[model samples]
Target chain A: MQQVIQANLKDNDNIEPVFSHFETQLNGERSSAWHQKRKAALEELKSLTYPTTKNEEWKYTNIAKVLANDYAFNAPSDLTKEEISKFSLSELEAHKLVFVNGIFREEFSDYSSEKGLHILSLKAAYQAHADLIEAHFSEIASTKEEPFTALSTAFAFNGVFILAEKSAVASKPIFILNITDTSDYPVIAQPRNLVIARENSEVTVIEDFVSVGGKPAFLNYVSEFKVEQSAKVDHYKLQNKGDNNFYIGTTQVHQSDKSNYNNTVATLGGGLIRNNLNILLDGEYCEAFMNGLYMLKDKDHVDNHTMVDHLKPNSYSNEMYKGIMDGHSTGVFNGKIYVRQYAQKTNAFQENKNILLSENATVDTKPQLEIWADDVKCSHGATTGALDEEPLFYLRSRGIGEDKARALLMNAFAEDVISRIKSETFKSHIETLISNRLENR
Target chain B: MLEIKNLHASVEDKKILNGISLKVNAGEVHAIMGPNGSGKSTLASVLAGKEDFEVEEGEALYNGQDLLDMSPEDRAREGIFLAFQYPVEIPGVSNTNFLKTAINEIRKYKGEEPLDAVAFLKKMKEKMKLVNIDQSLMSRSLNEGFSGGEKKRNEIFHMAMLEPKLAILDETDSGLDIDALRIVANGVNALKSPDNATIVVTHYQRLLDYIVPDFVHVLYKGRIVKSGTKELALELEDKGYDWIKKEVEEGVI
Candidate 1:
């Protein structure tokens, strides 16, 4: 493991420049309290090493090719209006914040909301709301345990920050679009986000990572969320980077007393993608739901690692992740539920299911539960299988051809997961995308 | 029309259908009553081209075509339908969608244009009435959470929608109550036409009371031991299979 880490560091062309750029930005006068925290975080990041397959959490996902690539780091590039328009979501009246190459693009953002909500770029938020930013930035994400979280903090330049004050309800969702256009050379971009929802607040956030041009690029992002007592928040992360892009993202969330947090991560396009989602249920009566749907084709690879920690008593968490792998693609799902000693009466359930279309397609799923409390109700299960032949025959016998029947069954398998999306338009859009993928096959 | 000559099938080298022979013309409903382990379901599965059962020596003819040579989907396209003894539950596929795909697939086989959404719904509504299936059930997943009687009714509903030339009901009455049995039988009886035939495979005589068969055959072990009219079903129900076993032992079957 140490040899792999040393080799990755020796071939590190993508991340050094970004670290230097962040250092250059910090040379100016620093008034925010988070500045000191950022300095400490960067020092902590420099001492840690990147993770490898030898690590238990990353056993099934290999990041050797990703660390070997030489990528440009956080270079400023002008984006046209046409390119930014491509990131618009259909049928959503949202406050859009666009980031180009991980730097906040103010000219293309709209932050006008009638509700008492603040959605600002991270740089601007750090300057404007230093106290709130200092209190929660990188609070939930542990730099010691995760190498990617440490790296993200070491080069935190610009990202989106959302704040919902006490008793405030943000009727419209806030959309964060991270666009990468690296046509000149391979580049790396680190986008770090922070979300804080105070007591009795309700909000929904959508974070989209997109690679605009068909260029070889890498995106490493970390998002930290803090949900206060009795608050409700729904978060969605959509990673549809270009086929030549590699992405490693970490989402860390902390839930308080009687709070509810729901998150959905969708990975549709990427050469090699790894997503780590961590939720800490720090208070009693807190409920968290983490759901994910990944569809891969060609030679793409997608890996999802999720952990839900039940720290207090009487908390509940449910997670379901489904993957459909076709062509020569591969997918991995590792979900763990942990019930601490004090977390009595914790009800946690996790299920992972995958469907392989081709004989060469592969999936590795491990659903685990570690319960210290005897009274906790916890269960986890994982299954990997081909399409059911009986259902295929039932459809074919109806006079549907074999191809169409297979497509229908495949679509139904994906639709079961897609229907869990709360937004109807989002659900339908995903349904259309899944249908197209199945039909094309 | 369908014909099976010297039909012998086995699974894992264990012979199930040993030289079984049967024939049925269109516009006739033939009932195959048998004791347990009589290879009744095996015959149905073999006719539908299930891959597990190996046909050691047999020829299944459907409309003068070699049925065994066709794939299951091809056999289905050739107007061969089998209402499964236990309809497989597909958790996320709607019944209406499944039926529409089947209908269009058969249409494609016949070189016909696919039905538009409006026309398909119109036809589905008509068939739903014939089978006494609720409209709500059509929108749910196929046979998911359905009761035994509902599954049988769904089979009849599918048979009505597909309108195959030959239909095989493999123990459709196994788990149904008296009222459900009557409803399912009535649905099948209503779908009878001169262009299509029905094969009702069952172990009991109660189902025949509703939809009386033109011919009844008793299968013992791997082959049919007796063939007669509706009176034969009554006699078998009265005397039971012990009499048939005794007759076979005495060389009087």
Candidate 2:
């Protein structure tokens, strides 16, 4: 482990300039209550080191390929209408916020809601509502051990800030688009977003990362969400970057009493992708559902690490993640559910299932449960298997060809998770996408 | 039409079907009644081109073509269907969609265009009526959480949709209750036509009472030891398989 860390540190010089520039930017800003916290986070990041394969959480996922690459920190850049339009969610016509290279592109954004909903860029929010932004940012995410979270805090740029006032329910969901264009050079962009749903408020946020062209880029992103008592919030993180790009993202959510938080992270495309999601249940009677679907082919690698902490009694958490791996692709799913001693009567269920299409395809799944409360009902299961040949033969015996039968079975394996999606349109869209991917194969 | 000449097959180096010979013409129903471990299911599996069973000797001809030479999908495309003893449960794939894909794949193999959704649904409604399958069953995932009777009915439903020339019912009456047995038999009887053939494999004579066979062959020790008309099934039911084994032991017909 020491040798690996030494090797990683030797290569860290390439990214040192980005960290230096981040420190300069932070020191240049005016002092505030949140400034000390940000400074402390930066100091933690400087003290800690990047993770390697020796780390148990990242054993199967190789992050060395990313640290070895020389990538410059990207600032705000001018994006044309044509480039921004490509990132729009045509299926969703709600309020949209477009960010080019991790910076807010206001000309391409639309927040036409007249309700008590505040949607602004992080920079704008820092100037306009510094108190709220300062109180919530980096508060939900742990910056001490996570190097990526520390880096995101140190080089935080223009990310969307959304605030739903007390008792306000926004009819439409807020969409945040993060577009990357690394055609000119290899670059890294860290976008930090903070979403606060006040007491009894309701809102939905959709965060998307898309690439304009087939460029080799790196995206390090972190978003913190705080839900007050009796609030309901739904979030979706979609990573559809180009095949040549790498993406590392973390979504930290904190739920208060009687609040509900639902998150769905879909990783469909990326050269190498790692998603770390943490949901903390701080209040009683709160419910959280974390569902994810990852479809990978070729040599792509996708890793998902999710932790659901049950801190209060009467809170429930359900997590289900499914992956379809083909070719030489690999997928890793590590899901942990922790039930505290006081979290009695808690109901938690977790399941991770993966299907390997090719002989070379692999999947590593670990569904873990740490329960200190004996009264809680908790169960976790993980399964990694190839397509059932008998089922395939049963379908073929009915005149369905082998290929079509395999595809049907594969799609069916993923449909259980896809159908659980609350939005019908989103479910159907994902269904179509999976079908097209199978068809192309 | 189907013809088997000295067919021999094995699984994992264990011989199952040894020097079996049989023949069936179009518009004929052949019943294979055998005792336990008599290779009744093995014959069905071998004919359907299951990959696990290796054919070490002999040849099978379906419609004057080499049946054993084609892949399982190709054999299915050539109008050979097998109703499994234990139907597989495919979760999340609707019955209607599964049947549609099967029908379209077979049609494509025969150089025909895929059916439109409306046309497929129209045909599916008719087939559902034949099997007495409910419309709700068609919308649910294929065979997922279905009762034993419903699984058998769905098999017949698939047979009706594919319209195979030769249908092999492998112990289709194993798990059915009296009423379900009657319904499954009735569905099979209704689907019978002059252009297609049926091969029924059963351990009891109860199913033969409903879907009467033109011929009944007793498979013992992986070979047909006796062959006769519908009366043979009745005789076996009365005297039991031990009587047949005695005859074989005594070298009598």
Question: What DockQ does each prediction reach against the true complex?
Answer: 0.61, 0.76
Tens-place lDDT per residue, model 1, B101-218, is: 7888788888999999999989888988988888888989999999888999999999988888899999999999998898899889988999889999999999999888999988
Those runs of model 1 whose alpha carbons end farther than 4 Å from true positions after fitting are A1-18, A26-31, A76-79, A212-214, B249-253
- TM-scores of chain A in all candidate models: 0.94, 0.92
The model with the greatest DockQ is 2
lDDT of 1 by residue, A1-24 (tens): 111111133333434554555566
Worst ten-residue run, lDDT, model 1 chain B?
B97-106
Weakest lDDT window of 10 consecutive positions for candidate 1 chain A:
A1-10
Best by lDDT: 2
List chain B TM-scores, each candidate: 0.98, 0.98
